[model samples]
Target: MPLTRRSLMDAAAARFGWRRAYGDTTTVDELLTEQSEAAYTEAADHAALATAKNTDALAVQPGVLDTRGRILADVLSLEGVLAGARSRSLPSEVVKRLEDVVDHGHEVTVLLAAAAVRAAAAHTSSGN
Candidate 1:
């Protein structure tokens, strides 16, 4: 079986945006994958939704996309220039270590923030 661009758009619209007009939307992991084809598939789905409805209603707005793109560019630039170096200014292995650290930092920051807020809320509710 084969699909035209039109059918792809229709299917994406069903998977994304306002299908039930106020229900659970797909997670980022669900929308993207390591497979390049799946990446295109998700883009097609997202494109379909944009074409089919108001783009402003998107749960994950496009500004976040710009921010993430900048972060990715910074990461790649550092990796290309500084990763695995034998120099003193910035060793290549140091860059690799930083990459691993940054990767975990994202999750760690989230957990730290959540814990901070949780503790604050508990203290406030308990009234000392």
Candidate 2:
């Protein structure tokens, strides 16, 4: 599979602790372009989620360094995407995807943390 919007979204979901699966199929170029904003939103959501998880690291919380590192990496990845798109002169639509990711980062992170907690509960129960 080359890469589809679904695959991209799946990758983002998995990065944020989603246990779901994705199918194999590359999306057509036009569809992929159309879904660029969705893809970026997903990535931004995951990045913010990671950030929220690590936000309390300075409060004498143990085991936060690792998560904080993960958040840092996610932010870096977002920056890389923006830079790459700009340098390559990618379509305006592609660049437009990052707008929400940059703007609502903190809110997304908080939401992500809540989602992670829920997923953790479900995972634990399912394993039992």
Candidate 3:
């Protein structure tokens, strides 16, 4: 089957931790403009869409191959964004979406990494 949203979510759940979504919420775009200081500046800002992009791009955390560390990166990245957004009072909806995306992204990343790890493990264990 193709990699649908359901596949992604399932993979994420199996590799990382489970995921849950809250009620409808605003998105990061709603809170900050593309040209806003937060969005443009290199500095870490919740209002900055760049920060969110970076978080998404970075995606996987170090040692995500290790089951124990699967969710750490996702949690930290999400927390950082949330902290920034909350401190700046970005809209509640923006905050909610940010949290949701981060959490889901974390799951996806960890799942992808875990699959790599499993492949490597199999290769090593099989001695070829």
Candidate 4:
């Protein structure tokens, strides 16, 4: 049978072990919409925290490198998940959510790099 959105969502739910509470009457679209909102919010929160931490680290020393490393790892992990979702023919909405998460991760990396540069310049001028 051709893959309808419902079929793909059902398959994804099974494969990813996504389950609703017993007797829950939520439709798949509703569930996906909730999950998408949650994913976006969580990613934004994480990116904000990471950006703050990296900024603090830059102020203190060159430890921002370690934070950047972790950010890169997160970006890679998100990319992997996105690739898997695409490969499984998940819904465009789901894929888009994942892409947004990945984009947030990338933004954190960029912020970290800029902070590191500023920190390095400050340290150089201060002869620290």
Compare the candidates by TM-score and give the number of the best one. Answer: 4
Estimate the overall C-alpha local distance difference test score of candidate 2. Answer: 0.61
Tens-place lDDT per residue, model 1, 12-48, is 8888762322233443333333246667879898777
* Model 1, runs deviating above 4 Å: 1-60, 84-96, 101-128
lDDT of 3 at 77: 68
Q: How do all models score by TM-score?
A: 0.27, 0.33, 0.38, 0.53
Number of backbone clashes in candidate 4: 0
Q: What's the lDDT for residue 35 in model 3? A: 34
- Name the lDDT value of residue 52 in candidate 3: 54
What is the per-residue lDDT of model 4 for residues 1-128, given as tens digits with 9 covering 90 to 100?
22366567667788888843324545645666766987999989878876777554345445666789898998998899899999999999989999999999999999988888887787677776
lDDT of each: 0.53, 0.61, 0.61, 0.77
Clashes of each: 3, 1, 2, 0
For model 2, the stretches where C-alpha displacement exceeds 4 angstroms are 1-60, 102-128
Query: In model 1, what are the clashing residue pairs, if there are any?
Result: 83-92, 84-92, 85-92
lDDT of 2 by residue, 14-125 (tens): 9998744324333455456657867897989877766777543232233333454566567667878778888888998878786446545545555556555655565566
* RMSD over all Cα atoms, model 2: 13.4
- Displacement of residue 50 (Cα, Å) in model 1 is 21
Worst 10 residues of 2 by lDDT: 56-65
